[model samples]
Target chain A: MTQPRWLDQTEMAAWRAFLTTSHLLERRIEEQLKATAGLTHPQYEILVRLAAAPGRRLRMTELAEGVVASKSALTYQVGRLEEAGLVERTTCPDDDRGVLAVLTPAGAELLEKVAPGHLEIVREYLIDRLSREELRAMTSAMRKTEAALRSG
Target chain B: MTQPRWLDQTEMAAWRAFLTTSHLLERRIEEQLKATAGLTHPQYEILVRLAAAPGRRLRMTELAEGVVASKSALTYQVGRLEEAGLVERTTCPDDDRGVLAVLTPAGAELLEKVAPGHLEIVREYLIDRLSREELRAMTSAMRKTEAALRSG
Candidate 1:
């Protein structure tokens, strides 16, 4: 058996803090989004990504990557969103076999309507809670973490 | 429609950082736990909570609250764990109507086996990636965020 590498005081504290912050923020945001717009956070992210794209459309593979979801999960989610008249998938011109997820006008409208409440919840749980210095430090720390995770 | 209250550049940057960091870390941790120990992070958390409780047991309601799961979800999860022989649910002696989730020896053993890998991923993606000052700032920031979430 390998040694049980336990966390020291500071590391344990930081890990606990990270866990609580992430879960609480996600729960609060998801609850409000579901209550108000009937959208999950991942759905919200998908719409946001498409809305930000050059033509308000992205290839399925790109959409899946942007949302951190598998292609099949993205397909199911996009299908639901489409059934709700929020988004539509079309064949990509650039790749004959590739599909594109396009934000419908209805989806754009819904997103615009939902953005305020989403940002408000974000503010209550995060933006308004932290000092500017803390925010800066957190952003920097996360960037480093992302880099480390990507490389190793 | 209320005003959009769009985020300023710094706030936007911090928010994006938080989103990416939280999602990537969660995905990485969950993937590793699932692959190595056949345990979801929530299941691991449940085991940990039970392991720490007196007699390695806790009421179902308390378990739900501690793990941020709904009662129904907790019931289903406990049922699955019980089926797997890692945990058992029994009527609480103090309250016949309430059920207790007890960590069986197998569950405790599984948690012990999983903890080191979990902590290693946590270190790689979080603790070891940030400076001490950054970790301290993040801890304080998360505490404030949690307090704000609880109050509202």
Candidate 2:
């Protein structure tokens, strides 16, 4: 059998550190959002996307892609948000399978209220921790990685 | 009410890119490992940690902390691994509440067999996608962020 090719020392360190940091950062954001906003990170992302879209609404497929979640998972999350009166779902005018997620005024208000604490957490754990050059590098790396994955 | 402190354009762009890339990268890694090794990313992490530990074993608490998982989640995961004969658990001599997780030779062999495919996925989605400077910046940023979280 051929020997396995492992990540070299530098590559291994970078990969492991990235994994750990991503895990911790996500958990921190989730916990903070849960505590202060009664929303999980994924749920908050959905709200943010809806708020950013024109008329504060998006098709379900668009919403799933925007939040980087599976269609089924997004469906469930959106259903819960709708149940909570934070969002409403309407059938798309162009397609029957298409469902649009619209942010309720309550949802927008909740997001506005939660933004301060969420931003504070982000500033503390992520933005404030990196230098300007580092931030730019990170963003560039992420975009590169995303493009590679899409092509591959 | 106090004024909301939100992320500026640069920070927001970086943050969103990071979030999307991290989520997609993890999904790709998990898909690759599951297909090639029949292991979830969390399970693979557990196996690798056990393999690296002295005596190929660590207490459940230590394992959870090392894997960055909650205790209940670790217990559930370990139970599944145990049923698959990939790992075994024994009571710690010093503490009855403590259980040591030991990697089976089978598990070590599995990881050895799977490491190449896993590393390839990591390379495609992460390591190879970044320039040398970007890689260094990422590692440094992660280290700083992790340190800040730990200290906080």
Candidate 3:
């Protein structure tokens, strides 16, 4: 077999920084959400997505895709949210077998309360630390990365 | 409380791209590792870290930190690795209560075999897609983000 190509200095540096920052950012967000609102990161994402959707609801599959959660994982989180009266599942109007996740008023209120803290964490650790040009460059790079992964 | 500052368009774009790209990158890496090596991402991380450590061993707590896993989660992954004969646990020579995770020959061999395909995924999706300037910008931004999160 041919020899595998190894990462060069620049690639290695970028990859290591991305990996460390991603883990740290996720942990920081989870800590803030759990401490202030008693919600996990995935649960918080579900609420945010649902709150932004048209009519404040999304089909279950769409919600799963939006939150980058597997169907089973989404179901479990949705169940917990349902139990807490934060979200409710309803039969799709157009498709009997389809389900929709609808955010409740309680969920919206909680999101409004929790969102400021969430934004603070995001800004303090990520957005505010970078220059506008740096942010633009990183965003363009990640967008390309996302497109490639999706297509591949 | 005063109204919490919200993300502007530029910040929002960067945040969303980062979130989506991080998820996609992780999922792609996990899928590649699972298919080629029958290893989960965290398990692979453990082996890699162990292989790079002095004498191919690390204390459990140090291993956990290096891999960004919780102690219990690291314990569980290490248990599985040990069962597979790829890793072994031994008491620390200096500290009786301390446990060290040592990489077996099989573990290093597996990592060498799996690493090529893993690097391919990272390069194809992330590193190769960005320009040199973009890579530098992202690395700088992420390094700052990592520092802030680590301190905060």
Which structure among the candidates has the greatest lDDT?
Answer: 3
lDDT value, residue B9 of candidate 3: 92
Tell me how far the alpha carbon of residue A138 in candidate 3 is from the true structure, in angstroms, after superposition: 1.2
Rate residue A69 of model 2 by lDDT.
Answer: 96
Cα lDDT computed for each candidate against the true fold: 0.88, 0.90, 0.93
Stretches off by above 4 angstroms in model 2 are: A1-4, B1-3
Question: Which residue runs of candidate 1 sit more than 4 Å off their true CA positions?
Answer: none
lDDT of 1 by residue, A1-152 (tens): 76767999988988887887788788899999999999999999999999999899999998887777888989999999999999998998878999989999999999999999899988878888789899899999988887776565
Q: What is the lDDT ranking, best to worst?
A: 3, 2, 1
Query: Residue B110's C-alpha lDDT in candidate 3?
Result: 90
**Each model's number of backbone clashes?**
0, 0, 0
Provide the global lDDT of candidate 3 against the true structure.
0.93
Q: Rank the candidates by DockQ, best first.
A: 3, 2, 1
lDDT of 2 by residue, B9-96 (tens): 9999999988998998888988888888789999999999999999999999999978889999999999999999999999999998
- Among residues 3 or more apart in sequence or in different chains, the pairs in candidate 2 whose N, CA or C atoms overlap within 3 Å are none
Q: Give the TM-score of candidate 2.
A: 0.96
Model 3 Cα displacement at B94 (Å)? 1.6
Candidate 2: tens digits of C-alpha lDDT, residues A94-148? 9998899999999999998888899898988999989999999999999989887
For model 2, the TM-score of its B chain against the native B chain is: 0.94
- Which clashing pairs does model 3 show? none
Q: Score the docking of each candidate (DockQ).
A: 0.74, 0.80, 0.88
